[model samples]
Target: MLPDFRVRQRDYLLEIARLLTEELDLEKLLARILKIAIEMLAGQAGLIALKETEGWRVATAHNIPPAFLSYLTPLLAEEKVADLDVTELNRMLKELTYTASMGLLNGTGIALAAHGQVIGVIFIFRNYADLFSANDKALLGSFAGQAAVAVHNARLYGQVNIEKQRLDALLDSAADGILILNADLTIERVNDAFERIFGRTHDQLAGTPHAEVIRWARDPIGVPLEEAITDGWPLTPNATLY
Candidate 1:
């Protein structure tokens, strides 16, 4: 039978996996990751630092003093957490905490990576000197794998949202009427000008067949709107059919 703590660990890992898949908001996801890591390790504090083009920066932290974060920033540049000298790190932490009037701290961290690319690092600190167990490292390694993927996904989602907003703004500001269509010629998006010219709102026209919404009168050449669109009929950018 599995030990009680082992069962709890399994459950937490499963829960974190669910969060990783469902949560797209970066801040909330990082907060939860740090919270779970600290709880699992019984740490006094923790932080997750992400590697950026400029360098490493703290993405989120729990119970860690803001002033001390800058001191930790340079430490994240190390390729792996295992490269850190624990005794020397602890000594430095002790001196820093003493000067800041905080508790003596010791910590363990793991590099967060996905697809063999290191993205970030997570560090959990305790007030005691007891070294982290092999089990602790193993659990953290498993958890960090999922966390790295989640963080990367959340960042990509954010970038996509930003680009979508920019596109929406550009579309709404256009002088000409615009209709975005699906492969089946259903209206997917209608710009503000299109809505105004047609006397219909986007909500009303969206998902409706363009043929049903816009009754296109044939030009002098008796060309239909569908054919004109398919054949690039206008012949010039500013040319109007009627």
Candidate 2:
């Protein structure tokens, strides 16, 4: 017979799936999952650690007392369970239990996996015996799947954002003013070079109509830029004005 908490946990797991499918930002998704996990498990603390190139980073945490977070630094840093297989994952969980026992962590730990790859781990601790039941483990495994996808997507998003920042920096360093307009002719982005050349910061010009910025200085043959993009004349000569 399943406990009432187990029944509630099943419902919560469904909610986790719904959130994972709807949320785009990984951080918020993970946070929500961790909160839900802690609530379902009745744990006092929860930590989600992501496998990084160097070490496991604490991506998100909940209910962890501030004092305990500071104390578990070494355990988190030294325990790299990234390359563990299922057998190794079981061993790692045992080790986590032993490690927690020594550090006053009375909870259950779960590994997050995707395509058989261990991407991260989650730990929940409480000050009670029978900290987790079989049903709790099953529910956590289900939630871990959703959490893994969210974590993977978040890492990819972070990488893309870093690349964009690098490209923006390079553009800002250029001598010529650059203006990026959307399909609707609305200004989307401008670099520092654009600000320097036009005496206007990107923040000031952003979302403004492109025509209001340079005033359609010149067409390809030194006519009018408004005529170029509009009448298909092409703004070739105006390129040298910057």
Candidate 3:
């Protein structure tokens, strides 16, 4: 029975890890994580507090009261993983005049870190009588690490896409012709201007050797080597561009 339980538990943990690492959208991933924590770990309430300039903000939450989250901000200033006992929970909630709904305040939290830098924290509050077990604490610890890495990767991918779009737009609007060559002398890129000036499509010029794509013959009027090359240049043998 223990072996079977272990196998099933490992499978579920892998699924959660996959979701945390594979989902590239930050908000969507956070929503999924909170939902999974509530369901899988039997958490009645959950929230992910991401560290920001002003302070920790509730980036995402499920069944978590705004007031309760506001109260946790100061404690979250110190990053660490901890399984909250009733003693500590009561101490933190002493001023709130705890309500019946707040009975499920026993749970665990972990600091979200990426590449050794703390980025955020995640919490899943469970029933006071049924506090988080050792297994639950370990699982949530693994989740925190995976979620942080996903956030970092998603941010990087978004920035790269934005920069690529910006560069493409700039190149398309440029007046001067531009051709970028690879280290092997093959054409890496040709801007819209280059395509128009050479009277060739981008697809036709790309990946072609510079020597084969450009006519390197002597000038008919004895113009200098560099001056001899002009806009109406014809392509060499085996060249697709005219």
How well does each candidate superpose onto the true structure, as a TM-score? 0.78, 0.66, 0.61
Q: Write down the lDDT that model 2 would get.
A: 0.72
lDDT of 3 by residue, 15-133 (tens): 66697557877788778877766665777777776766555566888876667666665664544313333334434443232453554356567777899876666767775667677
Those runs of model 1 whose alpha carbons end farther than 4 Å from true positions after fitting are 70-103, 219-242
Q: What is the lDDT of residue 213 in candidate 2?
A: 72
**Mind giving the per-residue lDDT tens digits that candidate 2 earns over 1-242?**
77786778678868866876678677887788788888878887778777777666678888665665675554456645444444554455446655756755566778888777788787777766664778788888887887777677766787898899998888888888788887667789998878887888878888898778765344445545455567553445445331
Clashes of each: 0, 0, 0
lDDT: worst 10-residue window of model 2: 233-242
Error of 2 at 166 (Å): 2.5
Decoy 1 TM-score against native = 0.78
Q: How many backbone clashes does candidate 3 have?
A: 0
- Candidate 3, residue 80: Cα displacement in angstroms equals 19
Task: List the global CA lDDT of all models.
Answer: 0.78, 0.72, 0.67
Residues 215-234, candidate 1: write the lDDT tens digits: 64754466666766777745
Query: Candidate 3: worst 10 consecutive residues by lDDT?
Result: 225-234
Rank by TM-score, highest first.
Answer: 1, 2, 3
